[model samples]
Target: MILRTFGWSFAITALGLLAAFLYEGTTALGLVAVLAILEISLSFDNAVVNAKVLERMSAFWQRIFLTVGIAIAVFGMRLVFPLAIVAITANMSPFEALDLALNDQEKYAHALESAYPMIAAFGGMFLLMLFLDFVFEEHEYEWLAWLERPLARIGKLNQLSVVIAGGALAIAGGFFADDPGDVMIAGVLGMVTYILVNGLGDLFEGAGDVDEDSEDVKRGPNGLAVATGKAAFFLFLYLEVLDASFSFDGVIGAFAISTNLIIIALGLGIGAMYIRSLTVFLVRKGTLHEYVYLEHGAMWAIGALAFCMLVSIGHHVPEWITGGLGAGLIIAAFLSSVVRNRNEDGKNQSSADKELHSSGV
Candidate 1:
């Protein structure tokens, strides 16, 4: 089953390596290899978070995530998004931006570097909100009780996330951001985007009415069409935003390694493909269900990444540190989950033994 899920990831990694080799000999190939590994390590948490949302999606949408989603990840975010950023920041046409990226690589990289503060601030706010929303909400299965319970209680207040996120933006824009005005605008937009996407998800969640047969479809008010179809579409939009929030740091960090967009696309794209596949793997194998505290761990890692990104606006936070912190949280969560699982098994066995003794003659 694992092989069936990950087979394409292995195949594509090889293809990506071959493409890297052909692009600029062995050195470029090694860089691509390193980038791919770095991307995967940094993004496993993304896979875990994606699994929670995706497990609710239908089979058709899941397949679309693997296919249509890959194209968007590779071409849209990896390629066009950077070019658009360069174009906007450098005050150049798209063609000019492309030319600068191709010919004047240093100038293009510098433009991106110059824009980092605003980008980091925006991404930081969005991710921070995601973390806060998760932690502050009521979670029945409390992994970190002392930590989570406090946050959940705070989350009970209306518009608390909005207030918290706004405060975060204020701190970021006031102290850390390069151009405070621009960074504030970007951060506000990021927070708004997060809120809107989450709101939409809340709106659409009832469309499917998963309590009923999830596969069953009902007609909507506007037309005789299926209600679930509209719901699924909105859910997809939310998931895409979730993906963008996760990838923001990765896209920014890739430039630290190489400014070659093609190389960046090839490498990060491969890692993204694997992450998507891993999302599916987790859903199919019930990995998230089995590992109870995994979601808590992923959210904590996201919070850590948000902190690193915000700090990077004022100071340099190395890629290794960002990746390492996330990996550590996830590992700790996994270990904690395993211990809980074992304890439950032992309790069940004890109960069974007690029941047998009580019934015996």
Candidate 2:
């Protein structure tokens, strides 16, 4: 299972490193490896969240995610995105931005940095909404029962997630942003993007209920009706937006390591492939079912990352801090899951022994 899932990722990693070495010797190879590892560490939570959504998708859509989705993630996000930001912020044409990126990367990086406030506000709020909605919704498993149960109860209030997200935006804009209006606008747009994408998905999925008996619809991992057709398309759209939000931090952070666009693209692209493969592996193996708290952990990590992004508007938060916090939370959740499984197994074994004794076996 592991080999089947990760074989392509390994192949790509090798090819990417080889290309990097050919382009700029051993130093470039080492940087590419580091950047790839950095992307994986930062996006590990993203993969888990993505798997939760991807499991509902059909086989064909999953293939789309691996193919078309990868191109968008690798080239679209890693390369064109920064250039677009530079072009828009620097008041230059796309060709000029590309020229700047290729000929004068320092100026390109500076131009991108100037746009960080909008980027941070947009990505931060989008991720914040995702985290808020997840925590607010009631779930079968609660990793932190004391916190999650209370929040879940409060979530019964209509639009509570929106209220909280709006409040957070207000706080971030008022306190953290140099230009409050721009930050507020970007943050609100982020919130709106989430609402529109998620709402369309829900709307189409609800529409699917009319034809639930049809072969195109099927039960998802959660036993709820899984979306197909237009519904699945919207869900796929949501996944892409979610990935873009996750990539915002990584893309910006990559500039700190290397201003060379080709190297950054190659490295992050390799890591993205592995993340996509891991998401598919999780779905196929039913890993989430086996480790109930993993999703919760990933959501919490996302919440932390959102908070960090917002805070980073006025302060510098190291990349390691964001990555470490996420890794720690996930590791803790995995350990807790192991303990839970052992307890359940012990109870089952004891019950079986008692039944055998009573039956005179």
Candidate 3:
């Protein structure tokens, strides 16, 4: 199972290392490896959330995610995305942006950084909403009941996640960012974008519901139907936008270590392949269903990351702080899940033994 699942990750890592070494010798190789590791550490929670979505997608779409979707992730997001951002923000052509990224990388990095407020506000608000919706939903298996109960209650209020996100944006715009108007505008746009995507995803989800009357649906003796068409397309779009939001932080943070666009792309692209593989593995292996609190941890990690991104607008939040908090939350959740599993097993075994004794086995 491990080998079947991680074959691409291994191939990609090997090829990335070889390319890195050949391009700029050992120094570039080390940088690439470090950045790849950093990307994995920072975005591990993203994989968890992605699995939840990907599992709902049709098998055809899942294949596309591994093949076609990966190309978009590596070339489109890792390479073209920063260039597009530079083109838009710096008022240049695609070729000129390419020149800036390759020849005057510090300037390119600066242009990207100059647009941080907009990126942070947008990505942060979207992530904040995603996290809020997840945790605030009532779950029978509450990880931290004391805190989650109140959050669930608060979530019962109409459009509470939006309300909280908007309030956060207001606080940020009023007191945090130097350019309050731009920040607020970007934040509002982000929130609106999230609502659109969320609604679209919800619509697609509704469409995916099983209809016994529909002749288009193929079924086994079990009479289950598959999801496809417009639903899958909208879900794909949602996943892509979600990925872009996560990449905003990574691309920005990579500059702190190196400004070479090739290095950044290769490094982060390698890690992205692994992240996607992890998403698929989680789905196929039923990791989320097996580990009850895993989703809780990932959501909480996202909340922390969202807060960090928002704070980073005016303050210099370190990568370690952002990444570490997220990793820590996920690790804690996994550990708690393990402990819960052991306890459950013990109870079941005890119950079995008692029944056997009573039965005179």
Candidate number with greatest lDDT:
2
**Per-prediction TM-score to the true structure, in the order listed:** 0.93, 0.96, 0.94
Task: Give candidate 3 misplaced runs (Cα > 4 Å).
Answer: 210-226
Clash number by candidate, in order: 0, 0, 0
What does candidate 1's lDDT look like per residue over 126-155, in tens digits?
889889889889886999999899889988
Candidate 3 Cα deviation (angstroms), residue 345: 1.0
The residue-by-residue lDDT of candidate 2 on 1-361, one tens digit each, is 8887888788889899999999999999999999999999999999999999988877778878887888899989998999898999899999999999989989988888888888989999999999999999999988999999999999999999899999988998899889989889889999999999999987777777777785556786567666677878998899989999999888889999999989999999999999999999998888988999999999999999999999987777899999999999999998999999999999999999999999999
lDDT of 3 by residue, 184-222 (tens): 988998888888988887776675565644432333222
Q: How well does candidate 1 score on lDDT at residue 2?
A: 79
Candidate with more favorable, higher lDDT: 2 or 3: 2
lDDT agreement with native, every candidate: 0.83, 0.90, 0.87
Q: Which rank order by TM-score, best down to worst?
A: 2, 3, 1
